[model samples]
Target: MRLIYCCGVVLLLTLFSRVSHGGNILVFPVEGSHWVNMDVLLRALHSKGHNITIVRNSKSWYVEENSTYYHSITVPVERSLGKEVITHLISTVIDFERGALPVTSFFNMAVGMMGTFTEAHRIVSEFASAMFDDQEFLRKLKDSNFDLVLTDPCWGHGIILAKYLNLPLVYNVRWLIAGEAHFSLAPSPLSYIPITGTGNTDKMTFLQRVKNVVMYLIGQTQHHVVVTQTYQKLCEKYLGPNSDFNELSLSADLWLMRVDFVFEYPRPTMPNFVYIGGFQCTPAKALPQQLEDFVQSSGEHGVILMSMGSFVSALPADMTNEIAAAFAKLPQKVIWRHKGDRPANLGNNTLLVDWMPQNDLLGHPKMKLFVAHGGTNGVQEALYHGIPVVGIPLFIDQYDNLMRLKERGGAQILQINSVDKDNFLKAVEEVLNDPLYRMNMQRLSRLHRDQPMKPLDNALFWMEFVMRHKGAAHLRTESYRMPWYSYYSVDVGLFLFGVFLLVLTTVFILMRCLYRTMCKPKVKQE
Candidate 1:
């Protein structure tokens, strides 16, 4: 798995240049903000001539019922699970930010994730029941003879199904949370790799390190406990009575994570772990006619784009208006992704759309600043386009991403709770007026772009590599065999300590005997 720079390796990869895989690839995309990056990989794999069938909720299955490059298998859902997911997610953050939730110990981030798992468990149960209960659907699915299954590890349904279907499973995760962090697929050392959601960078202060370890331990524990409890039922009922979901998830063939050492601290990663950061980005395309005109009409001031990503498309109505008020005051024209009815006081400079081409807007020459909720896809997109940001981070990993950018001088994070007109306006103006933000972003953009290969090319290559090798099991880490105590050398340290104690005790006993013999010399002679 070691990457070779030789001509042979190049020739081997070149062999796949026109490789149109005839195999069927099935994908199960998890709910929420992951769609941006997931779509990129699925589309690329489909374009490479693999039959890609995305089993998505019927509501969000935008793909036609029939197609050549891509198709959809509908898993009927009752309602938009979006509202429940984000409502619970935002509520957790609100509790933490207000100090209503205790953080002095393990309950810190663990409690929040318990709620998240419940939401995931609920949604996945609905999806799984729909899939498994329908005998026709189940028979058709098992007959598909999929070569591989692409999935989000947020839910265990994919892993369980892949195992049932006798196909290799590859986990493509958008979030780098504790569950993936602790997986046997790679090494994510806690000392450097900040606990996801905790806003620490690679270099942390003493207090931050202490907090990092606590968060790390708790997060991993919570993920294991909750997921095991929730998914074990599904696995037993559907897959097998004694089958464990966690073990199945860990046994996946490979992992394609939306992470890179450039954005994150340099850490050890197993060969099977692929970094496809900026996979959401592509060559910029023309904006919609209306958006193009708005930017054109703005002339010199440029345009500012604000989107909270798909998850948080609509904040509370009042909060949305308060935000719009800030945009109204800006010299630049505004494009806001709105999910609800337009605000009454909408400014002439602002335009509300259900969706706009996010990447295209960032790549636009006149995109002045991006105000975002700091989702990985949007953050990476902004970094790739070299645009300064006014980050309003909403949740866990978003906080860390925004903090990373803020520390690097490419952005300023306005507090999510304390966001009012003045504070929001100040952060926006600072990023807009400051040359450093632009300069820092340009440097980061270069670093992000200057990799040995394009992110998409790398993603395609590694996934193809998995196929070429029939599985990337060769790249799986040996850490899987190492026990927790042995992996950290704690047992060895204790063994050495025991030996030292034994030697010291023996020497002390001998010395006491010698002292007693010498002191009783006269009596001993008698």
Candidate 2:
């Protein structure tokens, strides 16, 4: 017994020593603190004994319960290479259309850069801008002995930074990104190809499935061209002025995604992708005192949480009024996250604040249903709390995510354009009253939480894995080399050929039997 105890202590000490010296990880958030995933991921890393530093804005405050050694510096928004000139030009065009550059423009640009001159231009421009930060985040990245660089897809700069530093990059995606070649990165089956094992797109409705196919087809050429061009430009900046775009595209290495499986269930996957979502150690602080008091007043009625997210609040005044009116009539109390202080004729049943503690509110026992714009973070929070939701998706992935939640039976969905008091009230009522909705949400919550290891630990482990392997080159190279047709082999020619062969065989067999019967002497007598 003494010998066994001594051996166990020795083993633990060895393991602890290895972990204490784990590789350094540098994280770059695509967006500011408003992004919930950023906070969650950082918290997860800190908990798992990983050394980390953030290259982000000073104003971007993310809560961490236990502080770890980190460097925080604001990257100046202004930089030259005059990339902003082109960015602003594109922004102007989009602003004209929707009063903003719009996230779709970024998606479009990402797809277009796959194979275009603009792709090269954007790559150089982004690199220049990223490295030009006044705080010298790039310089620190170079000086620091970082094992891996983790970043959001929106922060393409991280790719260049990793390349320049000869480090491995782990990409994080907050939402489902549809692949032109195969299935969408989202949890929904809408991206599946029927015959090809790439995905099972059959899980969606006929109309939605058709829509997915069409979208994929239309975006294919654009994505390829854009990515190819951007890679070329990136290569020229790093490799040489004479480097070919095609070769650069081939050399580009980006880890697909590093999210947790719980948030994206039932989605098909390949080995290169990693999901370490819900990395935030735990939910943030509870709701404020004033907010708590308002909810408690509702008693058995409970409260409904509503938010349109941080980036876009394009809900027209008329629509806002309609929503207010609907909430005014509900038996439940309403706590809305609206940036503006605009007063409405809503009854005492409503509470509007510039911002609300979303996760904390979801954790509340009195909280009943969540009304959201269906962003990934919000969806994760709602799922974590096992609260049924009514998703009024406005733009981008919101529509698709809302549909996913509805399909999962944990929420009701409503289109933004068609929303009114009646529809809004009805949707809220359905989520609140329907026991199945709560049960379904609870089921999803269990699945989300039932992972073998916490998302944070997995994220840190993988970050270190990539570091130990000295850049996950094998995964990236393999993922890139896979051709679209080969990846999703829904070959019409093969199907046709198989059918033809089957028909010919059947005909030949039947003729042999018929000829024998007709030639027989007994058949003639009959």
* Candidate No. with top lDDT: 1
Best-fitting candidate, scored by TM-score: 1
lDDT of 1 by residue, 1-526 (tens): 4555677778767656545445678888865566656777887887776778888777653334565667788877775356565666776665465443334313645564576566657676777777878888778888877778888877667877888887877878744223544334466666777877667888988888988887777777776676666677888988878776656777777777787766766777666777888877876899888788888998899999999887766766666777888888888999899888787667889988888999999999998899998888888989999999888876667778887788888999876667777788888999999989999999999898888888788877877776667777777765555667987899999999999999999999999999888889878789
Tens-place lDDT digits, model 2, residues 280-335: 53554666789889989989999998987765433556677888888888899998
Please give the distance, in angstroms, between residue 118's alpha carbon in candidate 1 and its true position after superposition: 2.4
Q: Quote each prediction's TM-score.
A: 0.85, 0.72
After superposition, the stretches of candidate 1 with alpha carbons farther than 4 Å from their true spots are 1-20, 57-68, 75-113, 129-139, 176-185, 236-243, 495-523
User: Distance from true position, residue 433, model 1, in Å?
Assistant: 0.8
RMSD per candidate (Å) reads: 6.5, 8.7
Error of 1 at 22 (Å): 2.4
Positional deviation of residue 525's Cα in model 1 after best superposition, in angstroms: 2.3
